[model samples]
Target: MTNILIADDDIHVLNLIDIHLTEQGYKVFKAYNGIEALEILNKELCSLAVVDVMMPFMDGYTLTKEIRNLFNIPVILLTAKNQIEDKERGFHAGTDDYLVKPFEPKELSFRIKALLRRYDNNPDEYIVRIGNTIINKKSYEVKVGKRTILLPLKEFELLYFLMSKPMQVFSRDHLIDQIWGLDYEGDERTVDVHIKRLRERFSKLTDHFQIKTVRGVGYSLEVNRE
Candidate 1:
């Protein structure tokens, strides 16, 4: 069954969409805030998400960005903000579609169907982003806003592994095993060199994320969300 998530602080709007999607045979997961929506997503394999722009804890744009980095599901921004800049921001945040409030349920259904069909045939991207920085696992390319960058294979792999689990600490040994493989003869200092290069490359370029050393532990990617 197709699963859809509807996150809105307004109860009436939330229930209304739930009823419409349920009637259309979609298993609906409803959330009143961005945090709840993400919690549900972590537990359920939702096909798509309908997110409102304003909410407690996290806003729709940040939520969409998170979904883009962590999950492959499509996102539709649902909000009352209909300005041109607002739509542009939504797209830049990685939303697949945008439906303003005061929308027809049928229109939403149609959009949902279109996105699901599109994603089903879409190729694997394995893309992860923090703020303005994006790293593509498939291409080994790092992009910050409009500029595209190619990192050394090891550095790219290291940054990708760290960012893939934001804020999660990994010791050098675990990182070596994960990034360099268990058979690698290189010592853990090699990890430090690659990490140093990655840091130098992005230090002045972007502030979207940071690789922080965990004192006695190792390093972790800390995403600075807006």
Candidate 2:
């Protein structure tokens, strides 16, 4: 059974989400604040987390960052702030999805299912090697030479997809569909954000392989021959 954590300052909101998620056959953990959420996460293995933005002690953005650093679970932020900037901030903080407050419970369930399905569907167990970088899809591990670095779920997926098909140009739309899913309502710029983070994360490792932009087309992974 999959365990899900729901954290919100509002008791009504927490209860609502808990009831719905539990009814959907998920084991639910409820927390009223980000601090409590962290405590639950420390003790329990949650498959996914639904976090509210404005919480006591720790905000959702900070909690999401902590979760990303410590856990590999997917996160969906729930907040009343629907501004593009707010959504971008949530994503930048390492959330896989964002849902505005007063959203339909059914929609929330749908997003949860989609995210879980995507996470569980590993392309293959085969290890991919490019230059000094080694990508192990099975273990969700990336090693640059002897050093191992962690990446957020979406970023890792993007890297795996690009590396899986080196030198193959992928359009932004294609990547967004493949990675974020066709039902993704977020801005297409999300792809650019993940790509930028990937470049920055691996910049110090090696230069033999690079992710290149094809101008108006999109991006591709280029492996240089030694």
Candidate 3:
């Protein structure tokens, strides 16, 4: 059975999400704040996490960062702040998805399912090589020559998807649909952000591969053959 940790300061919101997620056949763990959430995470293994932005001790942004640094689980942030900046912040903190407050329970459920599906790393589809860079899907590890580099979840997924089809132009919408799922309601700029992060992370590695923008279209991974 898949377990999920839901952390929120509001008792009502925590219970609401707990009931809905439990009814969906998930083993749910509830926490009243980020500290408790982290404590629970330390003791139990969960497949995913639903975290609230505002909390005592540690905020969702901080908790998500810690989770990303220490665990290989998908995180979805729930918050009342619906601004694009706030959403971007959540993504930058390594959250796989974001849901605003008062959001439909069904939408949250769909988002959770989508994230879990996308992040289900299979050992069979493990290694991908593009020039000197190697992507280990199963381990979520990236290697450039002898050095290893770590990327946030979203950035790593975006890189893997693009490298899977080198030189193929993928429109932002297509990338978002394939990577973030068709149910994602966020702006297309989210794709841009992830792409930018990928570029920055790999810039120092090698010049053999580059992510090129398509101006009016989208972007593509272009590999320079020797």
Candidate 4:
């Protein structure tokens, strides 16, 4: 079973997330503050993390920075602040995703699963042959034939997820839910941002191997079927 650490100052929030995640087959760990979160991080291998932005001792951004330096574990920041700058800072700080307050428990569960799916599938060689591109999961490196490309973590996650389910059309909401999380509180444009990044990266692989932007729909990874 995957292990998840959920850190929030609100006891009610912690309990709610714990129950929801536990029912979904994850080993849930709770921390009321950043200090406790660090303690949990020191002791175990967590597949994913859910952190609140505000708390005593250390904030979510600080803890995320520390965790990023130490591990490639995927993180979702929970914040009451829904500002664009906060989202940008969370991403810049190396959080894999973010969720604002007033989110649904089911949404939280989906995001956790999506992040876990991305993290747990990573292997040491750090290279994935998706279509004509060879993705280096570790260095965030991508190689299409002889060209080398670097990708942001979110872009990498999006590309990896789409490639994992080639030809499947993921609706914007479903894609967001699959990649971001159910409780992921953000505009759908977040998915668009990463998708654009993925397209730019794959453009190096030849436009033939690309993510199709389904009009009035969502996106799909469609390798040349001809």
Candidate 5:
């Protein structure tokens, strides 16, 4: 079983997340504060850590930095503040994912799963398969059955990224930064255009998966697992 560590000051929030994660078959190690959290970490090899920004003795950012320097595991920072600066700081602190307070437990579960998959996979080489669709990073081709489809460079990169995380939603800004360079000066709608092209190309060609827009959020590739 995969072990996860959840560190937070609030007992209610920690227990709530623990119950949900335990129900999902994860062995959870919980702590009421950052100091206690590190104590648990020293003994247990957790697959991932869910940490709250506010904590006694040490904060989430500091704990995240310690984890990054000491262990090779994914970290998700939870904070009540949804401001851009806070998010930037979290990212700078080496968090693999971020969640605002009052978030749905189900959403946190999904983020955890996605980050696990991401960290487990080799960044430079790996093939992602969902349903009948296969994204081959080595060849830069998407194979749907026997028919091999080659997408445009950006389109292919975009498809590969979305397929990589499967059901996880990625905002337009995040997508742009990953697929394109941080120095990319183009409009954010570049992501939209690529998504549209990928959808149009694959819609009639396969029933394996879909690039779904999440309205206010962004997009996720929903796999037809059944």
Candidate 6:
């Protein structure tokens, strides 16, 4: 379940991408604009993203540039503008790859797989190990030591986001936005609830607890130095 985000203003484009990517066995998240894309990007750590150049409020260039600064995630631009200057501009904006409009879905999928293999931390699988816990980001599975722990869908999602960037502080507001999304009518308390659950479960198994409370700041994963 490799996560992939597709940001396009056209409804048809979004539908097409969602259908094709999902059929190809990739977890595809779709957004109609850059703002929506940014919101989703904050929540899930995707292996790659396919973004349209022309979008309202932020556009592909600005969104991709911001994403690059935040995470070393790969971005592929889909643009009607196929000019050399446009491609150069996209590269300047930190785009890893680009595809002009009116392309095959299979080609896009192949390009995405190639980029992930070349750039992602785990090309074969999207898993991150912390302490003795194994996180399969694709399937949203969590295994502590040799035993597997079943987390509720939302809780599993929350834990994955927190673990993606170990030791990086995330404010309650930020966590809420990321886990719940901008449209979710949930408050900051939701973050606390999930954090409490995650800690309790992890504390029972591994001596090395990863989630850390930064007091007023919020929560972060504790990096084991030894």
TM value for model 5: 0.54
Kindly give the number of clashing pairs for every candidate. Answer: 0, 0, 0, 4, 0, 0
Model 2 misses residue 222 by how many Å? 39
Give all TM-scores, in the order shown. 0.62, 0.58, 0.57, 0.55, 0.54, 0.58
Candidate 2 lDDT over 122-179, as tens digits, reads: 4532466666787877778898878987778889889988876766788999999999
Model 3 steric clash pairs: none
lDDT of 4 by residue, 1-226 (tens): 8889999999999998888888888899999998898777656657778999998999999888866654457899999999999999999888998899989998888887787777667583255454356666667776777888766667777776675455668888998887778999998989988888777656755654678889999988765522
- Compose the digit string of candidate 5's lDDT tens values, residues 3-69: 9999999999989999999999999999988778767765676889999999998899998887664
Per-residue lDDT of model 6, residues 53-169, tens digit only: 999987999888766654557899999977999999999999999999899988998999898888755542466656567678677779887898778988888887776776678
**Candidates in descending TM-score order:** 1, 6, 2, 3, 4, 5
In model 3, which regions exceed 4 Å deviation? 121-226
**Candidate 4 global CA lDDT score:** 0.79
Predicted model with the maximum TM-score: 1
List lDDT for all candidates, in order. Answer: 0.86, 0.85, 0.85, 0.79, 0.85, 0.81
lDDT: which is higher, 4 or 5? 5
**Distance (Å) between predicted and true CA of 28, model 3?**
0.5
Q: Indicate whether candidate 5 or candidate 6 has the larger lDDT.
A: 5
Give the range of the ten consecutive residues with the poorest summed lDDT in model 6.
120-129
Model 4: lDDT of residue 191? 91
Q: Where does the lowest 10-residue lDDT sum fall in candidate 1?
A: 122-131
lDDT of 3: 0.85
TM match of model 6 to true structure: 0.58
